[model samples]
Target: MRENLTSVSSLNMAFTDSMKPTDLSADKKGIKRKNWRRRIGFLLKTNSSQPILRLVKNRSYRPSVDDVNQWAQSLDKLLGHKYGKAAFHIFLKSEFCEENIEFWTACEDFKKLTSRKDLVSKANSIHEEFIRSEAAKEINLDFHTKNAIVQSLHAPTPTSFLAAQKKVYSLMENNSYPRFINSDLYKELCAAAKGEGKHIKS
Candidate 1:
């Protein structure tokens, strides 16, 4: 994998054998391949080189995770190897993943876009930070934990608190609780307007 990437990098863009950009780049987040020719480079029917590395082919620009998936699928058709499929997915997690919303929408995209279980926990942490940040637009957590907090605020009973704890447990089932509540969780709690239901004087 390293050799092919390096070899492709060393090849001049004008080289007769170098791949034409049909529609991909390592940085592009939302673009798809068919419309990519106008944006990046030409997609070709044949790999720019042969035998230097038979395992993979890439584009002039750094190929994005989406492109890698397509290329890997192409190779899968040619080689009939399951490893080829596995490697492509692993590459997607590494290449497309980001610590901030600027790169990825949420940590969930990392999993939805790729099939790497090894990445879920780490990605979940980063996603938790992103959720807590002011810039975040989406919130992700289990519904149970969220409702427990809401119900506790509305009807403060020991039973409710236990239910809330159980809900929190549900959200944090596999991992430790985060240091801070996410913006989405906060908003949900605030939206309940528990105290607004009645007026009280200090």
Candidate 2:
């Protein structure tokens, strides 16, 4: 059985390799052949890994307003992933309060940097744009948090934005988050997800 399975896998690999395009010509025939090869290769790869890929693809499912609401019921669920952040951003944009989400997202991304140069550069950028007074898209932060960020800027580290980021997070949790849960947009999304008419409102 093991030998048979190995032989089948080798055959599948050989078939996939045979479909790869060899010619790089600019003519229609060459282009068509290349496209055909790519399509076949894609189909074979997807077919081979369908079970695992299905679960990964499902993670990317776009949530409706009701889905968002259910997620919002848990703070960790709402703030844990980019999907939640993106949904909140859309809602904030509609409400003209997008800066909060923007600042929060920037902080999240900033923490993921590995290079010292990038950390310093992004920290300064975040401070100038969101934490600095009279700056465009300035985030609402208390003096203590702003002062700590300023101090961190003098000797910027990966955690330089921690204080400010926390403040923005708390602001969203206490303020915009609740409003988003109850907004007309959330209701519409929930209704749409349920296959109801788009005009339905909560």
Overall lDDT per candidate, in order of appearance: 0.29, 0.58
lDDT digits (tens) for residues 1-202 of candidate 2: 1112112344233222221123334563444333333322322232343322132352334345555566558645776744455445555644446788778779889989998888888988998888899988798888988988888876677788877778777877888888767765455445545655333211
Q: After superposing candidate 2, which stretches have Cα over 4 Å from the reference?
A: 1-61, 64-66, 197-202
Clashing pairs in 1: 21-41, 21-42, 22-41, 22-42, 22-43, 23-36
TM-score of each: 0.19, 0.62
Model 2 whole-model lDDT (C-alpha atoms):
0.58
| Candidate 1 residue-wise lDDT, 1-202, digit = tens | 1122222342222122212243346743333221122111112212345311233545322223343333323432312333222222222222332122122323223434333343444444433453333423323435664454344343332232233333333433222212112222222222222322112110
